[model samples]
Target: MAGMPTPHVSPGLYEVFLAVARAGSFTAAARVLGYTQSAVSRQIQALEDETGAALFERLPRGVRLSEAGRVLLPHAEAVRDRLARARAELAALRTLDGGLLRLGAFSSAGAALVPRAQAVFRARHPGVVVTRVEGPSVKHLGLVAAGEEDLAVVSPAADRPAPEGVTLHHLLDEPMLVALDRGHPYAGRRDVRLAELADEEWIVGNERLEDTLFRAAPAAGPRPRTGLMAQDWIAKLGAVAAGLGVTLVPALAASSVRPDVALVTIHPDDVPYRGIFAATPPAPTVAATAFLGLLRETAQELTPATGR
Candidate 1:
């Protein structure tokens, strides 16, 4: 009886087996494969040796498949077809003709920077699929580091360092603006100093003073009164529109704020500009690299003077 077949056979052996079965003769298969008849005979013998079964029966006229060869025909064909499909899909990804792009961005970036870049990327590579998620910059940064996201737009906290395996590409430095009700005393001012608002009630997203927009500024005088806390942008802006309190807005979000609210630039000396960055892995995928370029282009259009 034949010994047990080899457990780990090469895919090339399967290809040779298939060719011989199709041509029905060693000479014909060798001619098709650009090999000599002896080479084809040796290949078939090696395959039979590994399989421990006669894959073909020798006859006076030609060769014919045996029981073992008949049984493996469909499996060999399936492997060939599957490998061909994989090669085509891989080629498509290389050419930007097809693939998935996983993107993440902070809330403010979703307003214009990310969306505009996404639009251009879609136009340029229609066959590529794109998915976007919005959340805090820290969360996006972690996701990028974990390889869950291909690229992310973030405004990382100056105090916190990015997780391992993540690299940040600076996109721009965004100035901060103060949102006040239309009827406020300084609403019409083109710009204002942070000290000027010391007496005014401040609307904040978090209770911790360090987490709010004022974090960029130094602890010069008394902390501003943050009596009201509204986590949602809509609630925060609503409070400002109702003359309840003022909230700081990133320049990227100025256009998206309530029309009734006034936006005045904060003197750079009071609060430094925040850095906007694209987080990526050490070696980004082709789709991710393309999208990064689009992000830079969109940032330029959004902030020509401040964009890096």
Candidate 2:
């Protein structure tokens, strides 16, 4: 009887095999893994040559694993998962210095939370680098899930659930306020009712789902009509100042309102408060932890009365 040839597969070939198996097609795997389809095919071919057995059967649509391929699939998956975990753990080990901290944040938190935290963190540990991107809450959360960001500052919203393999640190429950042109009818009022503004044309933030916490008395009946939608808070505030429409903003954000605009409390019974949280991957680095601490401190300073 003829004996099987000795296997001589390389680690790179195994990685390619695992990617193809997970993705179910060379093209799909290449797209997900940032490699060319030809490269993936070559690696699989090399793997098959080394093992002296066919690993895949070419089909009209794609390819299917052969007997040899099926036999190695579990082992390949294990190797890939182990290598990924090792790389992440090694990166965490170099957390103190010379590592990147990729952070994402919603617009309001980007303006206040991230800046102050970065300032303090850089002062304390100058070796670590900080990178930040600002977007809506849902987008920030998605980045965290996709491993594009190490940490994020996001508001908890019903539609945007926390991603897997991530942890959340509740920072503070910030009250929402109505921003109106200084000459608007409710600008001087101590508090405004939801019913009073139902018919008013509203300028809503682009992330309306996140800002909906400010829509007081939503459970009661009709809510304010959204006439304009802006992604940036500054633009929304500008719209409010231009008398385009009323907009709701976080109290912390409202603290820095323009001279032409005023922020007034909306009754709590009508509009409920929303919380801000510092979110990160399950295993964040020392630098990330240090930065989060500074964020907490900055939030406290910003709202001394609440003490964060």
Candidate 3:
């Protein structure tokens, strides 16, 4: 003998079935659902065809569930309950009143921008949990593409622009500052031209950041004489304080520099600047949207170009 076929139930059919089961009559279900009685009967017929069993017993006054419907009742109720819970969860996430926001950022943003935004967002929406991961810009961008991070704070290298499957929204253009020892010859100057520092030994935070110096260097200018390779901001500042070498600093970080080191603006027609971007997938999550707004707000609020 052939076996019975599996039923293919849609969410719509479940609603109709549940209405008819509760109302105990096609006319009453139709009235409750704003459908005609004939429409309700047709829907029941289609459901019966799909399930390969009669779910309602026709009576003179009303209808009652057949044995098949009684068996399906629990499963139908379970699906309805699960869907309701899912909708509620999604609503909470959309409201930003409660949910998890996974974010990634490069070192500089983690130090200043990310923290500032997180503090504001937490105060505004205490139920939302914001998590952060710090790494290179490329790594953060990749995480955003892979859906591991809802959004990322990245300063993408010019040559290696944003990759496919990710959108990088420009937030700000951050100027580079030269960190010098307080006693350096040009430390007292308000702003020193990059040309004046061509002869000084440099302390680079990261080898990759070497390009920042060159971009502001004069065409015929000699390359910076680099000595120490430090990755952390404090260490780079410490090196400059000890007179090991001067290092480049971004405006976002100038406020954090130690008093031992002075941050000087580079004067030139073309000042080297890094672009900060909020990276997201084509469709961003609700929490991502809220956090991105906070990131941009923090950037604009703290931007030296914007006045502080």
User: Best by TM-score, which number?
Assistant: 1
137-223, model 3: which lDDT tens digit per residue?
888888888889989998898867569778988889887778889998888776777667778888775546667557545484547
For each candidate, give its TM-score against the true structure. Answer: 0.90, 0.63, 0.78
List clashing residue pairs in candidate 2. Answer: 216-270, 216-271, 217-270
How far residue 182's Cα lies from its native spot in candidate 3, in Å, is 3.4
| Ranking according to TM-score, highest score first | 1, 3, 2
Task: Give the per-residue lDDT of model 1 (tens digit) for 137-230.
Answer: 8889889989999999998887876679998899988987888999999988878988888888888886232354556565753376768988
- List runs of model 1 lying over 4 Å from the truth: 1-7, 207-212, 304-308
Which portions of model 3 miss their true places by more than 4 Å? 1-3, 36-38, 54-67, 89-102, 122-131, 142-150, 159-162, 165-167, 215-225, 281-291, 305-308
Each candidate's lDDT (Cα)? 0.85, 0.77, 0.82
In model 3, which range of ten residues has the least summed lDDT?
213-222
Worst 10 residues of 1 by lDDT: 207-216
The residue-by-residue lDDT of candidate 2 on 1-308, one tens digit each, is 65765555578888889888877899998998799999998989888887778888888888899999999889888887898988876775476645678888887776666787888787767767789998877777777777788889888674456778678887777776777888888888888887787777788765764347644354653465666789777898889889888877776665466878878777778766678888887887676787788878887777643211
- 2 against 3, candidate with superior TM-score: 3
lDDT score of residue 65 within candidate 3: 97
